[model samples]
Target: MRRGWICFTFFATLAAMTRFSIPSSAIAVNRSGSGGPVIVSIPHAGRIYPPEILAAARVGREQLERLEDSWCDLIAGQAADRGATVVQAVWARAVADCNRGEGQMAPGEVALPLRAQFSAPGRKERAGLGVIPTRLADCGSLWRFPIDRHGLNWRLESFHRPYHVALSRELARARARFGHAVLIDLHSMPAIPAGQPGHGARIVVGDRFGRTADDRITAAVVEEVERLGVSVTRNQPYAGGHIVSAHGRPDRSIHAVQIEIDRSLYLHPDRSPDHRAVVRMSEWFGGLIERLAGIAPGEDEVPLAAE
Candidate 1:
């Protein structure tokens, strides 16, 4: 998994201008919710890259684009017209990955003294991709200099934390209104070889090995995708990530699932998103959200309070 299971094959170096746009806000929240208990989360599709972050990168825009879900927000937003609240991160993942845990880090990327705070870095982190990405594919380490405690904390407070806070708040609201909430954490992935050995899956639905969502929730997702005539798989290559682990609470009647779509399905070779492909996927996803809204814990199931 490249950076918490965002599968990325070696990205051919590409040339794009420095992304140094700083909007007034870093995230977008639509708490009003479409019409149901569904909340759409577009965590990895952000493109905003402040000047400071651009200056720190050792790779080009193409490599950084691999970090993005690449317009995944559009698919979620287009499909969310049916009563789903959408929480989107406008800040690029190159700045701070919204899908990773706050403590997850690559030790070597942080200054030595600050590195002592973490006894172990996850495999992804050790590979130089973590909450604050330090490496990419063959490009090696991303930063020229190690991040200090101040820099690390600033990235979390400024970008990562707020996105999670907004997502959690919206989940709480959706649950309060409908007695249960469903979070569809949307992401995109490089294509997996079909009819081959390992993962022939194009649509991978992850519920953290069923720890984050109920069996019924995950089942519905698989069924819907299968209905679309696309190959889907369970938690093999990706069993969800921090977003699902942290926000998903089936015991609390809040279900979360991370869906990884094949970029080749909608992304053109030139790197632009195909409009028709996006619409078809959007229609399918919109229906999936609607279907999930009809599902909730049975009367025998007791929901715990959200902490």
Candidate 2:
């Protein structure tokens, strides 16, 4: 019995290593140099999970699907066609969340020293939605067993680091070309349950309560979404995450704002996005990007009357 158990463990570990050995091209960048100052970042829309990660998953596929910002990449792609640079992650967030901060590992989760230094844990880390997530909302925990530091480091180096590097490079390029850059971190939120106070809101714009972006830019985004007949809120449940905090520098003319669309608007009853709804949302997003692009570098920092 002991010999059989040892053999099973060895084979499982071997399979994981073999699957993870291949280099992952997890980030896709599309730049058209159409002179647009906007860069759309879709970090959570990925659906691909590497075989090594899949082997460790404790949750069912459906539960993992819930973590994705479904069809968000498609919506961002529309903006990309209209001259906006798009940088998106292709690896599933369950494997390595690109939006999370680098140091957001759970207490004693992995025992390896990272090559690069990282900051202290953030709120998401406390909630189990860290850089390498341990749990999801409906599914308690995702990993069947504790992963070694080496495996964790591989995920960070292969998927998480590359995604951010591409995003940073795109932002720098946009800023250099246009004298300013507006990073629209696109995401989707789960449907608001019945009887929620802000249930009517279809869109949530987060600028970290005016810290990550200029109030004028935030106002412009809110107004645009409201014009499309979608109720909008600012900095309620989610007030932007690590992406916005790390990249946004209004003083330097680099602004980052997170936009969260209610999944109910585009997703059908089965959680798959309706093509027609996605088209409409994409159109709306395209217009929003155009409006943002028109804002001059200095104009965004000014306090608008609405604010």
Candidate 3:
């Protein structure tokens, strides 16, 4: 029963972040026991898929596997115990990428195409990595049969909408409890060529070119993690994805940062992750949360431990 349960050291300062109860299921969220300034989002770390959709996808059990969040959930799951609320997707990313805008539609795709003009099919979509992937990596098709409108709606209703409803609710609740909130949209990048630009930093901290969030919060997160001896970079490779574009608004005092961790750090190219290395990374993140939790929007609060 250790599917999603993990333990961590607790601190009084961490008690500031509050925990929220969600319906019990594979997708259940584990909110921080304390109220803190940070909210960690693990959008792509899902593995559950509807039976029908799985059957339609022509891929073998292992072949369809390439599209998983791998172990991103286990790493980010630690956030909930460290004064940061964690929101994760229970349905598989192949069902729908929570990081993507609502417009993503795959024709005969399992999910109903929303009634909106999405960004035209660009690199991410053509390569079968859009909000709703049409294919898998290496130019592989995911479906044995074409998807229809009704089936798409079924997935939308059963999977997509429910996920966002939970996510939006969590964000709203956090903002209400705390004067301000910060969302860390967590994801993992393939060690191989994902077609994302730049050499790909081990950890890419994105703030949407300084538009979505404040500079100070961004600086604190990036600097704290880098101090842990990990190679970190800025907006070059990942300048935040749909979650950032949707929820990040520093003006409203609800900030979001997209943290893209390189898969190679913890996983091999074959898609298997090293659990011990992942825990090491997670422990480092715990220390970072301890530091970020002390951050103050105004000049009054004390600087972080290192400062």
Q: Estimate the TM-score of every prediction.
A: 0.86, 0.85, 0.81
Model 3 TM-score relative to the real fold: 0.81
lDDT of candidate 2 at residue 18, scale 0 to 100 = 61
What RMSD does each model have against the real structure? 8.3, 5.0, 10.3
Model 3 score (lDDT)? 0.67
lDDT winner between 1 and 3, please give it: 1
- lDDT per residue (tens digit) for residues 95-155 in model 3: 6677776566543333244323443666676666666667865747776534444444444
Worst 10 residues of 2 by lDDT: 298-307
After TM-score superposition, the amount by which residue 66's alpha carbon in candidate 2 deviates from its true location, in angstroms, is 1.7
Candidate 1, residue 109: CA error in Å? 1.3
How big is the positional error of residue 304 in model 3, measured in Å on the Cα after superposition?
Answer: 8.1
**Over the stretch 1-307, how does candidate 2's per-residue lDDT look in tens digits?**
4543443365356646765453546877788656477888888998988766766677777787778998787676578767788888888888788888777766635434542333365566766787887877766877765545556766777778777777788888888877778899999997666676456688989999999887778888999998989788898767898899899999888899999998878888787878998888888898888788777755543222221
The alpha-carbon deviation from the true structure for residue 144 of candidate 3, after best TM-score superposition, in angstroms, is: 2.7
